[model samples]
Target: MTDYFWDFDGTLYDTYRGMVKSFVIACTESGFKVESDQVYKSMRRTSLHQTFAIFLKNVDFKKKQRIVTRYETVEKSEQTNDRPFKGAAEVCKWVIEQNGRNFLVTHRNKSALNMLKRDQFTSLFTGCVTSENNFPRKPNPASLNFLCDQYQVDKDNSFMVGDRALDIEAAHKAGIKGILFDPDDIIFVETVPDKRIKSLLKIIV
Candidate 1:
C-alpha cells in the first residue's frame, strides 16, 4: 500500500476564497493597491513570495510585514469558512480502508488541525507536518523527508499530491512520485507528474 501526503489549502480544502479575500484586504489596508483578480491569479499560479513580489513590487520590508500581519488577522477571522472540497474526507477514509497511510504536509500552522477536526478528518491522518514544525518550505524536500522518516515510508510507495509545482518538485526532490490535483488546469508546468488527477476520488489505490 502507498502512503499519500496531501496539501491542505487548494488541494483538499477550498481555501482560495478566504485566502484571496485576506490578500485583497491586506494589500488595501497596507496601501499596496492590488486588483483582487490579480491577487487571486498570482496566488493560485505561483508561490507566496512571487505573489507578494508581483503585487507589492518595490515595497519596503516594513510594508510587507504589515501586509502579512493584516492577512493573518483576516485569515484567522475567516478560518471557519474554509471547507474541504467535495470527496476530500471520503478519499482520505478510502485510503485508510485500503491499508494506505494518509498524511498532511501543509504550510499552515496548528490551526489546520482544528479545521480538520471540525470536518471530522483529524483521525484520518497518521501525522501532519505544518509550518509551525519549522521545516524548510516546499521545493526543498526537508519537511517531506522528515514526514517520510517519521512514518518509515518507502519513497517508491509514496506520493505527494498537491495543487502546486512546489509540491511536485518537493516530491521529486525526495525521490517520490507526485500527483497534481489540477481541477481547473490553471497550473502550467514543465515538470510532468506521475499522475494528474482532477478529483480527490481519482486518487485510488
Candidate 2:
C-alpha cells in the first residue's frame, strides 16, 4: 500500500488567511506596514521565513525575532480560524481505507497536532513529525527520512503531498514521490513533482 506524508499549513488546512493576517498585524504593531495581498503572494511563492525576509528587509535580527514571536502569539491565540480544506479529512480516510498509512510532516510545533485533534483528525494519522522533532525544515528531508526509517515505509510507494516546491524537493531527497496540491493554481515552482493536483479529492492512493 502506498504511504502518504502530509504538510499541515496550506496542504491539509486552509491556514494562510490566519497566518497572513497575524503576520500583518505583528508587522504593523512592530512599526512596519505591509500589504496583505503582497504578503500572501510572497508566502505562496516562497515560505513564511522568506516572506518575512521580504517584508522585514533592513530590520535588525532582534526586531525580526520580535515580530515573528508576535506573529506566532497572535496566530496561536487565533487558531480557531484555521480549518481543514474540503476533502482533507476524506482523503486521509480514503488512504486508510485503502490500507495505506498517512503521516504528517509539518514545520508547525505540537500546535499542528492540537489543531488536528480539534478537527478530530488525530486518529487518521499513523504518525507525525512536527517542529518539536527538530529535524531540519524542508527542503531538507531529515524528518521524512526519520519517518521512513522508523516506520519501515516503502519509499518507492510513498508520496509526500504539500503545497510548496520545498515539499516536493524534500520528497525527492527522501526518495519518495511528491504531489503538489495547488488548489488555486497560484504557486509557481521550478521543481517538477511526481504529480500535481488542484484538489485533495484528486489524490489517488
The whole-model lDDT of each prediction reads 0.87, 0.92
In model 2, where is the ten-residue run with the lowest total lDDT?
182-191
List the candidates' TM-scores in order.
Answer: 0.95, 0.96
lDDT, residue 184, model 2: 78
Top-scoring candidate (lDDT): 2
Q: Scored by Cα lDDT, where does model 2 land?
A: 0.92
Against the true structure, what is every candidate's RMSD? 1.4, 1.2
Clashing residue pairs in candidate 2 (N, C-alpha, C atoms within 3 angstroms): none
Clashes counted in candidate 2 amount to: 0
lDDT string for model 1 (54-129, tens) is: 8777888897888888888999989889999888988888889889999999988988889999988989999889
Q: How many backbone clashes does every candidate have?
A: 0, 0
